[model samples]
Target: MDSYEKLSYVSITPHAEFLRNFVANTICHSCKTSQRKRCINMADDHNLCSECYKTAVFSIERLPYIVHNLRKFYRQFNLKVDKNIPIFLTDKVEMRKEFDDKTTHSMTVYAKKSTTLVIKNCLWQGEKMEAVKEPKKLSKISILLRFGYPDVITGARLAHEMMNVWLGNKGCMDIQQNIKEGICKVMAYKWLDWYFCNYVDSSSDNGRLGLRYIQIYKPEIESNRAFRGAKMAVDKYGLKHTLKHIVNTRNLPDVNQATALVKIMNEPNEINTVLLAQEEMVEQRTSRKMGLIFS
Candidate 1:
């Protein structure tokens, strides 16, 4: 897959087996049962026994609330758009066929130009005339999210795609693929962390389930070496500074350069000492490893 595509994987497990194993060790928040015939874990701090789970699943709809919350969460980033982008809950088959067999969770489509009629001026013989046959080039953005994912998973996918939208809107689409996708991954991971901290009740059963999901998802997002490196940059510098650097330079900040700058700044009078010390540390470590190999 192209690094720029920004794909996420989904894990599908049988509902029956999932429930059986889930309730085996964890207490159901709804029925307060550690041992139940069947139980299902849910997002938002609610684990339910078989009957309660069925009732909750059948009667309660959480997608709208999730979407609303996500929209609200996105606004906090301050990535403004001239208009609202449309989001559609779609099936996997409707998504790109290349990812059909790959268990793709969601995708954002950005079109450089959408079809629209525009007036064109022309001179017929001697007089000027207007023609309407030509089409104007206008950019379009839309999100296609596969239905049936758990609420939290759906939220994460939406968060990822929304970052894509933000990048496109900001005209950062021309940047290097690894760097662009790495930024998207960073945003998605940040959203997941924010969601867990602000929304999930860490003390509740649902909160525990949410944390487990975050643990599983975060590593997958960070699996890319570029993504990991980008995250390190964000950690060392602030997000605002990191983002500004990416936008201004169209590249990730050089780690070696940043480290040297930090050293120089911290010990301005001992710049040479710092450099020599760093070089000596590297040589000493290499010498110890070589000695171990020879011995």
Candidate 2:
């Protein structure tokens, strides 16, 4: 029987003894060597040796890319990736979406013999149990070492952004799930930032005449901050009105004011106090620059 077909005969066993025995007996999906205590359970009933598992963990955020590139790297020398090795992933699926459904419904896993895992808790219905401790952040040093120069800097920047999003989500400590959710959130934020920038940048000259340019060119602004600023201005200033209403309005806020509005929205209490103290200084500086105030 084929290896995949052999997996069908394997029962879903949650007994710790079974996990140990399985590891001891199975040939590593990577090296095809029966290395005792060196196997880890992977998706779709496969197991990888410690060395192969470490490689996968190192490529966590960019697993698919790394796998593809690995083949390409070897192909340059006219070789193929070893076919005997197992691919742990059965299907490419969004991690967050899959886990979100499980979490939301409080679904618990129970080891079944073949297809599904099922457990009956009827006998211990009233038993008390200790709460599960939250998971901690996973280290990425191995992954970081793989990058060089600008790639390292870029990776650090994105990782920072992803951490912010993850924290904002009150992320669970589960390392794999956290990373997946963070990646999804970062991608969404980037799309929105790009959308807004392109929409504003591509508008006609009349629409781009003044302060809007500042928003278009705001360097290194977080997408969430930009979004909050736009939202605040729209809600507070009735920016939803017709273009005629906007054009006829007097003392309309310029782009700098809009960005300041964003900052205030994001850090309301702290920014309010700080802005009050700095307002006079900023005004004086502006006046001097415009030659309205002599030095």
Candidate 3:
């Protein structure tokens, strides 16, 4: 790209022609332009002069853009997300709208029978139990990683789930019946951050933007790419025997494996328990004529 086309941090080429045509519109009678008032994108209010707008456009719009983008301006920044992770996205079927009958209520009510995971508490539970709650410090991303991406759920599922949740009651809203859904939503949002956004440069800062663009564009991955790459490295040099030696095993269900684990549990403080002293010489010195005391 040439210098002329290079993206500038500031400076906007106003659409004077568009604004003029719009201002001339019969519906725009109340606009500041009708009173010979200048309207700059930087203005706090539409009535402000172009000279005053010199500093307002970039800074003020940051907050309002975030708001408007989610609402009426969805089409402006509605990103194309890719499904790379095995994340799932589903919408509610408006069965309730069709019937106000009992069957509709029964189907809509997702909360089914609840079952206890532990029927018999452990010996530790025999004592008085304290209020058990989740650690509040765990963010959504941390929670998803802790859960380690549930079965058949991928990053793609996460991205869409996040979008749905973020929109709240709008745009394909539905009840998330599973705890993993909550996890997936959080993962989806973070995943979205990485997929969306157009960064100006390839540097780390802009690299972040580029990544955000990707997350927004492509949400799911079919494989754990880094892990797959590592697996490929395993066959790089036909070092199968080397890995076997490192593992140190005979056949299945080896007793040595258990013994090795136990030894590891109570590790030695010092290596090779050996002393230079001779038992015979020490016994000779300590023996007070006590049965020759020799080994």
Candidate 1 residue pairs that clash: 45-206
Candidate 3, residue 53: the lDDT equals 23
Model 3, position 94, has a per-residue lDDT of 24
lDDT of 1 by residue, 1-295 (tens): 5332332322433344344345444555434434644444442224445444332322114455776777766665445443467555544344444244445657766773554322222111111111212333434776666543456667778777777777667678888878877877877777676666566555667765666566668778878777788887766654545666777778877766877445533564454444345434544654564355348
> How accurate locally is residue 141 in candidate 1, as Cα lDDT from 0 to 100?
76
lDDT of each: 0.56, 0.30, 0.26
Residue by residue across 128-188, what tens digits does model 2's lDDT show? 1111111222222111111111111222233333333323234223334333333333323
Worst 10 residues of 2 by lDDT: 120-129
**How close to the true structure is residue 117 of candidate 3, measured as C-alpha lDDT?**
15
> lDDT tens string, model 3, 86-164?
1111111222222244221112111223221111110111111111112122212210110111111223343434333
Comparison by lDDT, 1 against 3, better one: 1
Top candidate on TM-score is 1
The 10 consecutive residues of candidate 3 with the worst lDDT sum are 116-125
Q: Candidates' TM-scores?
A: 0.56, 0.18, 0.18
- List pairs with backbone clashes in candidate 2: none
Order the candidates by lDDT, highest first.
1, 2, 3
